[model samples]
Target: MKNLNVKNFRDIKGYVNHEGLVMKARMIYRGGPLNGLSEKEKKLIEKDLNIKYILDFRDEQEAQLMPDCSFDNIVYERIGALIGSFKHQGFDFGNLLQGKMTEDKLHFLLDYIKDGYKHMAFDNPAYHRLFVLLLKNDGGVYFHCSAGKDRTGVAAFLIMMALDMNEEDAIQEYLLSNEYLKESNDTLCEQLQIPFELRKNVNLYSMFKKSLLI
Candidate 1:
């Protein structure tokens, strides 16, 4: 079998990702502080997958944390996350979702759902622009963020809905955030010197599910 090699695939400096229906789309990466993947596997993707682009859902900090990606023919587009800083409390989504403020304090985040979450179909110009790209004859597109919950989940939900996926399917997709955040769990667990139980909040799937009216 022709093994996928990241080093070889990185020749073009494009982000390599899973190509065919060989597996489910996931949050796993080939390399990171946690369970890192091999460059060979990444090469397999570049050699076989038809990925057209990668829609990064991460904030600036998330990008800085991990920044070594290269692919052959794929494009990487960073769509600044919906999260803004919570300070000033004006319209800063970062601070609001930074473990304080309305998210847990006043809990008024839902008030902006139509603009920030549920109604994201067109509310976020960046997301919509990518959606349009996906709608075209693009090979495949993968969207992701830090935990793949909240902001990323909302984007997933809206995209699925637009794709005509049934509500059940859309809901299930959002729930995938739980598994996606495992990486964060490992890091937070050791960083906070706490058990995995306390780090359960790392699972972001439910956060998105809870925000929906359906």
Candidate 2:
């Protein structure tokens, strides 16, 4: 992965697909919220990566709360995935994290997230639009959500599957966010007053793995 200094940024490349061909680099990238991108990071991506398209999956409120910086020559589209209700409304992740952070609560969260992934894969109009944009884009495409851990991660998983990547590899790529976003996740856990041990036991990777398989 090229270190572009963008927070939680990663290139979805170099993996072998089901057809036994290596995935192309610099075509697509995924990462955390670009709303707070630094001037340098913005220049780096805009100039070096030549990213022409950005598919934002954040909801209207979230987008208004912390919108991505407007860059010259880049086209951005906001198509939030359907977690519930209307197609325009985004997933209620904050509400989902409410209640005791116990093992059982963890299971419930995973179950909800798994079903959400299924919705994004098959039912979400935003994801359908993303698939079309990816196929049509001439340059690199950058896609993300607020943390780029849950919603954006699910989108990445679906893209991998669409490209005919192996199931395990696709899952592993999705799980890579555990490492790439660990620092931010830890900070968030602390801010939420969640104990380190409890956070450690959440096992989001395994939860998502099982969810996709099921």
Candidate 3:
């Protein structure tokens, strides 16, 4: 699962559940978009990982703009877990890039993300379908959003909980994305010319801190 050319890609195997049982390796994976996967990478994912289902949490516009690389025998589904007007739920990175991230805007964005997490956790059809797919499919299920950190993170948390993983363990798993995506995030900060002091807040926009879970 490591060095697979996909951002934030990792096998959910080896994590201990509440029963103190480790999850089977290669049975589930999570990551970012699969748009630019190479042939070799696709073969690795198909033949090695055995991913049978790909559940995308991105909205229609996001998927259309950068569709996933299709694999034979894999079922693909797009379920926008946000469940609202895309524009309203979406974060405006352009504003951040333009140095418009004031304290008020930062607070607003944090509240928005926290609200989004709540929505995904409760009464969200996308997560409902996700559980259905998990039950129906014995093979691997690879689920992701644009960055695999918000909607995708919540989905991962739910799945771990269903497997009887503890609250703290599930939160730890969700926070791993910040580590996995560090390189990409740093590159993004460089591109946006974010000051060292502002980079932490900017990263918070897409990251899942333990505080957010609480």
Candidate 4:
């Protein structure tokens, strides 16, 4: 992944690197690996940013789907969604496949993400400590979920804001996941036997991208 200290995200060349690390699909975008990151990339980022801690926002199923990224001596934590007792509600195999959740229900779930952030910002003091510990103490920290676009996107936005990066740039950074994620989305759609039109419905980049940060 390029450092992305530039603009014009619509054109991949607008980004520095020209390894064809760009995609026509405009939803999920990024520059990394799903199976395993290139050591060269990892080393470059680590050396550049002094990364030390890794926060993976994925659940067990996600870990099973894509092999976890393991660094030799770095601290890794899974601060996944605060689903709490309802954590299993969406992963009961047949349940999530149905996509039976109503729009209101989905909105409520999204609200859960928002509420969690509220707690971190105001209610939970420990959240601040942990966040600072990660950003300042850790050489490099990478937070990711199943798609690394939803939960991870939120964390990335927070970090970007903390780093004093502008809000628009933060949004672009979050959108980078769209590039690397569309192919994965296509693969998942095929596995679930999703039809064409229905697959489009599941792609929520347009409808939900603006909401992930909040």
Candidate 5:
């Protein structure tokens, strides 16, 4: 999971099929919102990578809030996975640090994420749409959510699974979010002026990543 010059862009590398064949590099990518890219990065994506398809997993409101930039002749598909319903509820770090909320609300939050991931991969109609896109697009396909973590990770997991990648490899790919987005997350927490302890308590990406193991 190497971070790209383009923000939050990652190559879905180091995963292998059952036959021990590594997934092709530059064929499939996952990323955060592409709207903040510079002109050079835009050309790198369009001209060099020739990324032909994008599956945007962000909800309508989130998409409107930070819409992706237009790539020349690229097909942008909005396959909202209903992750918007999993909004952030305020966290109580004092209760959490004291082990009060851990068994209750913290577990509840993690359970919600697990269920959401399962739903997105198995039951959501967007899954079928994603399949269709995969069938139609031969070139590189990039999928993203708000932070390119949970929703995008689920999409990557499902795709790797379909391509015959084993459970461990798929999970590794999913967990790469922590490594790839470390800088972005740090900047985000600093920008929001969130306390370090509270940040750890409310880290949805970390919670969600851990939940996928079970």
Candidate 6:
């Protein structure tokens, strides 16, 4: 698991639930898109992680643009977790690239993200299927979206809560993506030439901690 090139990759093992029961290791992993994994990295994911299922939360357009690398014995399922919501509204990253992400637009984007989280938590059929998949399969299940910070993070929060982990613990786990993706996010902001003021207001690559209130 160490030295894997996949961004935000981590296991949910060893997390203690509210009852003080430890989560089993290697059974559940979360990370960013798997489209650009190296041969060595693929080997590690396939052999070391023994991942049998990949629950992709990316929309169809996102998947089409950058499809995941195929692996032996892995069943991949794509669920557009935000299909009807902000997926169509399209928060323009071009604004960020041009240093034009105003505070008003940033707040609007945060609202959209928060709404998306609520939809995923309450109304999305994808999560129901996810729980069913987890209940039936005992093998490693790897789930992710583009950055693995928003949709995938919410999924992780739901999963932890479903396992009887406390809400605070689940929220903390959701926020861990910010820490894990800091290097990549910093590099991205630098490359995109995002303004220091905008970066100060929000992380373009992260989920808001307040979004978990849902």
Instruction: Tell how far residue 178 is off in model 3, in angstroms.
Output: 0.9
Q: What TM-score, computed on C-alpha atoms, does each candidate reach?
A: 0.60, 0.85, 0.88, 0.56, 0.77, 0.88
Output the TM-score of candidate 4. 0.56
| Per-candidate local distance difference test | 0.48, 0.76, 0.76, 0.48, 0.70, 0.76
- What is the number of backbone collisions in each predicted candidate, taken in the order shown? 21, 0, 0, 15, 0, 0
lDDT per residue for candidate 3 within 2-112, as digits (tens), equals 548777888887778767898888777888899988899988888888888999988887888779999888889998877433336464455544655466766766666
- Between candidates 1 and 2, which one is better according to TM-score? 2
Q: Over the full model, what C-alpha lDDT does candidate 6 score relative to the true structure?
A: 0.76
TM-score, cand. 6 vs. native: 0.88
* lDDT agreement of model 1 with the native: 0.48
Which lDDT tens digits does candidate 6 get at residues 1-214?
4668777889988888878999998888898889888899888888888788898888777888779999987889998777345566653354434655677777766677666555567777777777877887678998888888777877888899889988777877877887888887788778876677778656522445545453
For candidate 2, the 10 contiguous residues with the lowest summed lDDT are 84-93
Task: For candidate 2, write residues 31-97 as lDDT tens digits.
Answer: 8667667788788888888788888888888888878889898899998766643233346556656
After superposition on all CA atoms, how large is the RMSD of candidate 5? 4.9
Per-residue error for 159 in candidate 2, Å, reads: 1.7
Q: For residue 127, what is the lDDT in candidate 2?
A: 76
Better of 3 and 4 by lDDT: 3
**CA lDDT of 200 in candidate 2?**
63
**Alpha-carbon deviation at 74 in model 4, angstroms:** 1.6
lDDT tens per residue, model 1, 1-214? 2343221111111222233122233221211111134666555554555556666655556667765366767677777656333111233344444452222433355444433554444456557756776667546665555444555566666655655556676676556545544555566546545444434443444345444664
What C-alpha lDDT does candidate 4 achieve relative to the native structure? Answer: 0.48
Give the per-residue lDDT digits (tens) of candidate 5, residues 109-195: 566656555455666666677777777757888888887877777788889888898988787777777777788777865765556
